[model samples]
Target: MAKAVLLILLSAYVITEMPQASWANRPEEAPKEKVTNLQFYFHDTLSGKNPTAVRVAQAPDSDKSPTLFGATFMVDDPLTETPDPNSRLLGRAQGLYGSSGKQEIGLIMAMSFCFVDGPYKDSTISLVGKNPAMNPVREMPIVGGTGLFRMARGYAIAQTHWLDPTTGDAIVGYNVTVFQ
Candidate 1:
């Protein structure tokens, strides 16, 4: 009988001393989400003294492939309210894109739009998708985000507002819809 009481006491102590990780902040349910629509422009500069994007690597056959397959570029482009680079600065789009299509110019983009202005300051939205360069418009997925955009899921429609054919510099307009 004494041994049974000691065992019960030990079990109670062990249960109370267990790690808190398994019990902390366990939400009973998901929070209601709000939908937001955002419009912005991304400036991808591949030329000039202060280019925002730079080629990082390429496959041996990248030069041979008209599509530049396997070529990768890291970018830190500016997000603006207008297609103009000098427009109101909204945020920065930082990430990497790689040429993945063998016959066509399909870019696998993985980037985050880090907002620096207004209510969304210090927040970010992550995007990942295949961008067909020749297409007039492309759609990308917003997988997730942080801060104000936590648990974000949505899509961004991209259209080339302007392109420098000779330099591959472009201003892409984005219309994004997000549920957070």
Candidate 2:
């Protein structure tokens, strides 16, 4: 009886230890898509100011004015670092409106990071926007600095101010897109 029990236990162990061909023979995963370019746009609605006027002349290539995406700014500032380390830029804005009455305006700034989709998916990029703030115009500093900023992987984006609420200016909106 003991011999039979031992034989049964050994068979069980062997079966459990055996590797399955299906698991071991699974196909390899596909390569990930690489992010190559980052595009940005800025717009303002304040009187006498054109937010689209903001330019990044030092960009790697000429800027594209896409009617669909508004105006585009090339992310090619020689001084700006690339592959943003934080993978994001702080968006900030401020405005002053009335000269003789109660001056009032809204402010909004947002930073976003792009990421790849799940496995077996198209190489589409998605952005995560956050840190949006709005308040009455005070004498506070905007929040962050721009120009020649450093990012991850030595990649950088050239940022320019298109509106200043403290000066009673109106800005439309800003857009940033990372290309693969």
Candidate 3:
């Protein structure tokens, strides 16, 4: 199972397009190419007061902006060290997704992986994902970063590790490979 997951994550990264050169104007200082891999668990609670999941309407009328009537929310609370809920803190997944509505409206999202602990503590790895609402397996492009991950670029694969249908809570697995 682990091997299969790894293979899927790797392939996802290969399939996504690399960051466009126009996004950054600075020259490559250190190594032009470097790869870093990060595997962590994410817990998303959709039922909280400041819920991590929410539907956003572009206007008061739902029909006004169908494609823009999607949802935006956060994946901010989770255990990175272990799948267990009580594990040590790692960071947060600050994300937003949606179009107007439906499942196939050219879905996309910009998510920030903020690491509060570990070797990459206080750093952020930004990613842009397409087709975001299509279930458990999806690939996102690594655009840039801050702190230890400065000028980083790579891809991330997210898999549904577990979900609680009753509470709308979930545990997700993320495999991220970045070139700094």
Candidate 4:
């Protein structure tokens, strides 16, 4: 009985250690990961005939506050290849930003970068985070995307390229890196 049990155990161990036969033709491997870097500028026009960004909401005390602490604006700003308004059009940034800081111009942004031309045509990337308006450069997270940028994750660096003190219009540059 003991010998029979030992033989059974040995047989099991031998079978487990034996190399199994592989498929005659293995399927092709999945596509490799891709990392993409994109640069563009947003033409945020506030007080023009055809405004891209417009004030949607505001608090009673917002007017009194220097930073417009409780103001919110909806934007459909044009995305350009360069800071110049006449530069090649890339897409649009459609979303909203609100003043979150009481003492400074801290904006909470939730927007999508919708592409219309080039390799990213019909794709969109979502960005949501706090933007320190006064900072020379601010970084925000690239949460996710759709179409060509599906399952994307990365970061975006924004710098104010130009500002109109009178109209409060601005051209902001964006550098985005994405991995999928």
Candidate 5:
């Protein structure tokens, strides 16, 4: 009888531990599905300085938050009329803003923006574009004397106006995911 009781207890223990063991043995599940391609509008707040980091906001009313994505400073391409050295081809931009005291001039790739999908909040949407390169130039007039100059610091710039690839109209933001 004692053996029978022990067997029953052991069976329950085994059942209880089985799930954990199975989970441990199995590969970890992928992270929750997130919005992949998101478009953000860019506004050149600094005409002379290159933007380094981008702060994403849920809406035009929301506060801007930092993100992993970035942009670069480049002249607008004459052919495409888009920012040159596109983010799709070059990758994310690198460099620090405010280093030259003068804001950098050029386009940057920004990842910060917020959108709503159904009833769920979708802040995972990232800007899709090419990164830029660092361009060192002499300081401009205003901030130049103060040891400040406009430097292409290689940062992502969010667009204040983005042409929807689908509709081809200027859009502030768009939804990339669906909520349950």
Candidate 6:
């Protein structure tokens, strides 16, 4: 009885100390994810920035919260408009307001970044930003992606790099950092 009890304790100790070798054979562990960072320079034309007409109300006490807006834009290196398709392509942004009352501080913007040239041609990155005015340096979330940027998630810092009040032209600098 004493020898049997000692053997049982020894087996328990060995089991506790041994690493499960079966784990190694249960399919090689997935490759570690690569976190990558990428930047994009683009120019946006704010002349056509308008609220959606579908939700337009004419009543005196109607809810005036504009839910959607159209943002027309063109992407460029050094953010300049050029005829070269390699350096420039048409882009669009749809702003979805998330603020209540007449305050214009909080707004969520989902921008679809389309690359018409280079290695990521025809790829789109879905970006989301909530409450731009709440922080001094607003951060936008990278929700998803398509094509070469598959399963992308990161943050983008959008600042009004330059705004031309005369033509309503804005050079928005998007320092986009994405991980696929």
Residue-wise C-alpha lDDT for candidate 1, range 1-180, written one tens digit per residue: 999999999999999999875423666554556999999999999999999999999999997998889999999999999988899999999999999999888999999999999789999999999999789989999999999999999999999999988899999999999998
- Cand. 3 Cα-lDDT: 0.73
Summarize candidate 4's per-residue lDDT along 1-180 as a digit string, tens digits: 999999999999999998865543333554667999999998999996999999999999998999999999999999999998999999999999999999988999999999999989999999999999889999999999999999999999999999997887999999999999
Candidate 2, which segments miss by more than 4 Å at Cα? 1-30, 46-158, 161-180
User: Tens-digit lDDT track for model 6 on 12-103?
Assistant: 99999998767456667745566766555555443444412122223343334342223222222223224232455544343333333244
List TM-scores for all candidates, in order. 0.83, 0.24, 0.66, 0.83, 0.25, 0.55
Task: Show pairs that collide, candidate 6.
Answer: none
lDDT of 1 at 2: 100
Clashes (N, CA, C under 3 Å) per candidate:
0, 18, 6, 0, 26, 0
lDDT scores of the candidates, listed in order = 0.94, 0.29, 0.73, 0.94, 0.28, 0.56
**Against the true structure, candidate 1 has what lDDT?**
0.94
Worst 10 residues of 6 by lDDT: 51-60
Q: What residue pairs are clashing in model 1? A: none
Off by over 4 Å in 3: 1-32, 48-50, 54-69, 99-101, 104-107
Query: How close to the true structure is residue 180 of candidate 3, measured as C-alpha lDDT?
Result: 86
Candidates 3 and 5 compared by TM-score, better number:
3
Residue 125 miss distance in model 6 (angstroms):
0.9
The total of clashing pairs for model 5 equals: 26
lDDT of 4: 0.94
Candidate 2 vs candidate 3: the TM-score winner is 3
Q: Model 2 shows how many backbone clashes? A: 18
